[model samples]
Target: MSLPKELHSSKFEQYMESIKIMYLIDDRFKMICDQYCISKIKAERNKQKSEKYLYQQLENENLSQELEEEILFYIIKNM
Candidate 1:
């Protein structure tokens, strides 16, 4: 599928709010986060990798179909 839509900051905020709601109701959200490597998140948070690398990781995991679309959308929106 094509890359997700371009996100504005307001859109991002709204998406995050939606995620909080989803996280409470959907086990899939938690499962996706639990599956993703913590160290990878730390690395991204610390800006240890290039944006290209971050996108690559997301794209690869995305293609693997391991994450539910909502979780992937959340991750991409945040990134």
Candidate 2:
């Protein structure tokens, strides 16, 4: 199965096979991936706005990083 675009990363390339398995068999992993994608989009959109853009973009980026860390932890634990 094709991975979510947000999951396409050189950092994750080594774990690609495990990630694909987790994405298919793990609901929480899938949800996190979905949320990561949304957060990424929000961060991008924040670049086009003003005033609250910095705060919103930072928030989204932090969340994305946390989610990525979680994904990595999960993959490592299961591997």
Using all chains and alpha carbons, the TM-scores for the candidates as numbered come to 0.31, 0.55
Query: Residue by residue across 1-79, what tens digits does model 2's lDDT show?
Result: 6788878888889998998999999999989988988998898787667647777999999999999999999999999
Clash pairs, model 1 backbone = none
Model 1, 74: alpha-carbon shift in Å? 62
lDDT (0 to 1) per candidate: 0.60, 0.88
Lowest summed lDDT window (length 10), candidate 1 = 1-10
Clash-forming residue pairs, model 2: none
Tens digits of per-residue lDDT for model 1 on 13-64?
6576565566567788645544554544566677856777889998998777
Model 1 ranges off by over 4 Å: 1-11, 36-42, 45-79
Name the top TM-score candidate. 2
Q: In candidate 2, residue 63 scores what lDDT?
A: 100
